[model samples]
Target: MQLITWNTQWCRGLDGVVSAQRIVDGARAMADFDVLCLQEIAQGFDNMPGAPGDQPAELAALLPGFQVFFGAAVDEFDAQGKRQRFGNLIATRLPVARLQHHPLPWPSDPSVFSMPRMCTVVTVRDPVLGPVRIMTTHLEYYSQTQRLAQVHALRELNAEACAQAAAPPKAETEPSPFQPKLHTPHAIVCGDFNLTVSRPEALVSAPEYQAIHRAHAHGRLQDAWPLAHGDTPHAPTFRLFDRTYGPDPVTADFVFVSDSLAPRVQRVEVDLQSRASDHQPVLIAL
Candidate 1:
């Protein structure tokens, strides 16, 4: 399976371009990405300039064959008295089995007022891979404190969801010995984590990686990047070669996996060349 994660910056390209067609075209050119995780998708949010009336719908229209799920981190009334959304989105070509919305903790910064961050979970049945879970999220970018808390919340949420699914169904009826039992499904955590694995406090296996590690330890989620590229020069997923930003930047987009699904991790690539969005899309294959 091929998966891509990008922060679309409300589908507004660098300089004054705001075209969903261009974004979709760029994504299609990369590869037939089975799942696409998009962050910063604006939908009638406060009547901002270049804001689409309905971004998710527009993207769905652009990719006719795909099923889409949008999780609104913030929903407020627009000037026209209609509800508007600002949040994360996932588009997939496979049959959707489940969809969930998980809200992340908001920051306390007084000056950095913005919409809340959230994670959208999409479960689909891949033709060759059976059942798979795709979780896409954009975390708090400003405050490290808030981001750390959000990470912990995410780990606990995932564990709870997975555990509930694994539990046997409650029923008074007798079970059939010939019936097949399903195992706990695998999950793909892809998004702009904002917290990099290079940071000791963000790693799942490290002592100071924070409570998120503890939560995932029970859930069995593992970092897929280090597993695939282990200390390689995959730095700089952002600020693409523009001399104005800085000499070097850091990577914030990530693709993580459940410990049970690590064996199926085929490859992970940080596509630094794509200018579909301000942030580069991280592609992962299984």
Candidate 2:
């Protein structure tokens, strides 16, 4: 199975043009993927950069034969009284058995600007892997306090899933909303994590990276980059060579999987040439 994760910056390109069709075209040019995870999609907000757009509807209309699921972290009524939403999306060609939306920690941090964050989780039936849980999210970029809290929340959520998989709930009667759904320990968490290690002097440092590795060592989760390219530095997924957004490039996006699925990681790559968004697309093949 091939999966792609990208932060579409609301489908705006370096040339200051916002086109949802171009975003789809660029992703398809990168790889023939079974699953597509996107972040920073806007809806019914005319004030955003280029123009007002319903990105979710536009993308769904553009991609035929794909199940589109959107989880909005920011949902409110605009001045025109239309529903405005901004968040992550997961579109897949595979069969989805279950779906859940998790709102991440958004405690008030007046020290810096921030926004509400969320994760979109989907349980899909892969042709080879059977039941697989895939989640995508974008963390708070401006506030480290909020970002760390959100990270802890993600870890807790994973632990909860693992616990549930080990001891599932009893089956309920048919036609009930409380019916037990498929839950798996195997999962893939991918998106613009807003994590950076380049400037240990200012922002995050080695401890953050160590925490993630420790989780992997305990047989909970593992980073896909090392599994594909051992000991190599991660490729830049944000900023990179795009000066339109700034010259200081850093790696913020990632694809992480459960340790059990590490061996199935065939390839992981970043599309360096695409300019459909400020961030580059990361693809992983299993």
Candidate 3:
């Protein structure tokens, strides 16, 4: 399976134009990806400069014959009482078996600006691996406290999934909601983790990020970059062209695979040339 995960920044490019078509074109230019995971999609928020106001619909229209799953991390109303949503999206051509929208922890962080975050998981039937979970998310960017809590929540969710996979529920005789869903230890979790800085070693060198590695490691989620590339440095994924957010580029986005899928991880790459968004896209082939 091959997948690409990117933070589209509401499909806004460095040129200050929001075009879902451009985003789709950029990804297609990079590779023939079977699945696409995106973050920071906006809907019904025209106040954002150049926003189309319904990006999910626009993107779905762009990708025909592909199942698109969108989960709103921030859902609220504007001054005019129009509904607004900002969240992540997962698009795949594979046969989907189950999908779940999980809201991450949102603790009180009065000192910093933060927003509700979420992870959207889709279980697609991979011909080789059977039921495989593709989880995508975007964590809190501004608040470290909230981001840490969100990371813990993600680890817990992974643990639950692993547990369910290990112990299948009592099978139902009839087909219904209670019917046990497809369970497998195979999973790929990828997104813009918002875990980078001016330092090139920021991906794994930081103490907080180290803890994150350990947490996910305990849950069977290992960074696919090292598993595939081995000691090679990760290519920067954020602030490459704009540099408005930071003086230098760093890799905030990542792809983590469960231990069961790590051996199948064939390649991990970053498209450095695409300026479709402020953040670059990361690709993983398994």
Where is model 3 more than 4 Å wrong at Cα?
215-218
Question: Which runs of model 2 end up more than 4 angstroms from their true locations?
Answer: 199-205, 216-219, 243-246
Query: Which lDDT tens digits does candidate 3 get at residues 1-286?
Result: 8899999999998889888999999898878888999999999988888855898898899999899999999999988899999999999999999999999999998998888999999999988777889999998888878888877777777878888888889988899888878887888988988886667665577644665566443357888998888888888999898888778888889998888898899999999998889999999998
Candidate 1 — which residues are off by over 4 angstroms?
107-111, 169-183, 196-217, 241-247
Model 3, position 75: C-alpha lDDT score = 95
C-alpha lDDT of all candidate models, in order: 0.75, 0.85, 0.87
Clashing pairs in 3: none
Candidates, ranked, lDDT: 3, 2, 1
TM-score order of candidates, top first? 3, 2, 1
Q: Tens digit of lDDT per residue, candidate 1, span 139-160?
A: 8766667777777777877787
TM per candidate: 0.85, 0.93, 0.96
The pairs that clash in candidate 1 are: none
Query: Candidate 2's residue-wise lDDT over 110-210, tens digit each?
Result: 98879899999989999898888898999988887888788777777777887788788997879698798787888898999887655523322554444
- Against the true structure, candidate 1 reaches a TM-score of 0.85
On the 0 to 100 scale, the lDDT of residue 128 in model 2 is 97
Deviation from native of the Cα of residue 20 in model 2, angstroms: 1.1
Clashing pairs in 2: none
